[model samples]
Target: MSSHEKLSAAANDRKARLAQLKSLKRKQAPTSDEADAAPSPPAHQAEISDAIVRTEEEGEAPSVATTYLSGRNYDPTTRNVKLGFDNLPIADPTNTLEYKAQQLALETKAQQEAENKEDNGLDLFKLQPKKPNWDLKRDLEQKMKSLDVQTENAIAKLVRERVEAQKVIRQKKPADGEGEEVGMEGSELVEAMHLKEQEEARDRRRDEEDEDGIYRAKVRIGTAFTLALHEAISDRGPCDILESVNIRSNPSVRSKTRWKSVARAWI
Candidate 1:
């Protein structure tokens, strides 16, 4: 084979290996991002961990230093500090301790004076009493009672007027003649009259016939009367005699009476 062909084969092989590595890297990229974006710690745990880190970084020892003495070493155990005020020779021969004690005493006196000034500036006396005013509750109650009485009277008067007006209207409008007649006669009374007429007519025809037909007619009429009485009494209290009479007169219910009577007698 020629040198150019061998070099081409070698280049193809290298390219294939590079492509394989690239594919592998693509597959692992998502896992890398997932690892980097791990879930955050819980809030309470994070706070506690942060507190521990801060406490470790900042030593936990207390430093006994008073602001009154600058550039002075303070004993942590005794919580005492020596002032450097008199370290340099000056017009005063008093020791640093004595000067520090005088400064402390002056500061204490000033603080006490400030406290006294604050206390004296405050007014501790009770406030003066306000003038007595009218009782709103009692006033409102009296007004409500007055209004209730007035409203009740007005309502009563209005109702009375309306009732009188209705009475007048009723008096002026006469009842219909037909309705009045029907009301007076009643449905039951009319039905009873009709039934009685029918029975009388039947009896008259039966009398004209021989004995057997007359007895049958009498039996039929008796049966009809019994059925009507039963229907009226079936619902509640014994059928009102007046109501039964009216039902017998009623054109609608009256027609069924004959059939009901026959059924009753047969049974």
Candidate 2:
């Protein structure tokens, strides 16, 4: 349709709605006769309803609820403590046969549990001691001791055999002036040379041991004397201490002391 027809139709519809709303308002309004016959509300309630209608008409602010069906009536500083009822007996019917049977069953079950809790004989407090780091040394010491004893016994046995061999050689030795051509056999000569070599080797080892002992004694004495001199000269003049050391520590005196220390170590 054309724009002018659409506008006219919309205005006619708006007029029809306004007329219908006015008719409904007229029907809902109380008539003068009905207003006189109906019971009136209290004066205070009438005032409150009039105030609510005026608030709704004004455009200043929205209205809020002024009356409450349920309201708080406690003081701000007061605490609400709940009373305890733990001492009160249970609400179950205690005199009944079923209740008594249940109580007896509970008691018997508790007694059975108590009797079953007997001693198990396990001691939780008896702890084993921990093994230390030096336990390795402890275990090896016994084996080392056995080995050393075996070595010493073997050496002693070899020494005894050598002694017997040497005695036999000496007894069978030919006299220097005898004309008899009684000479040592090749095996005997070889044995004699081997024994001589062993003796030489043993002597060399002994000499080395003696030298080592003497050196050790010298080192120990020198260290001790140095420590003692250092302590003694702590409060003395350096020049005087040096002079006294130079005078007292002669080569001959040092040699004598070294020998004394070595003798003591040997003893």
Candidate 2 Cα misplacement greater than 4 A, ranges: 1-186, 234-267
Candidate 2's TM-score reads 0.20
User: Which residue pairs clash within candidate 2?
Assistant: none
Model 1, total clashes: 9
lDDT of 1 at 22: 43
Consecutive 10-residue window with the lowest summed lDDT within model 1: 61-70
Question: lDDT per model, in order?
Answer: 0.59, 0.59
Collision pairs in model 1: 187-246, 188-245, 188-246, 188-247, 189-245, 189-246, 190-249, 191-248, 191-249
lDDT of 1 at 93: 58
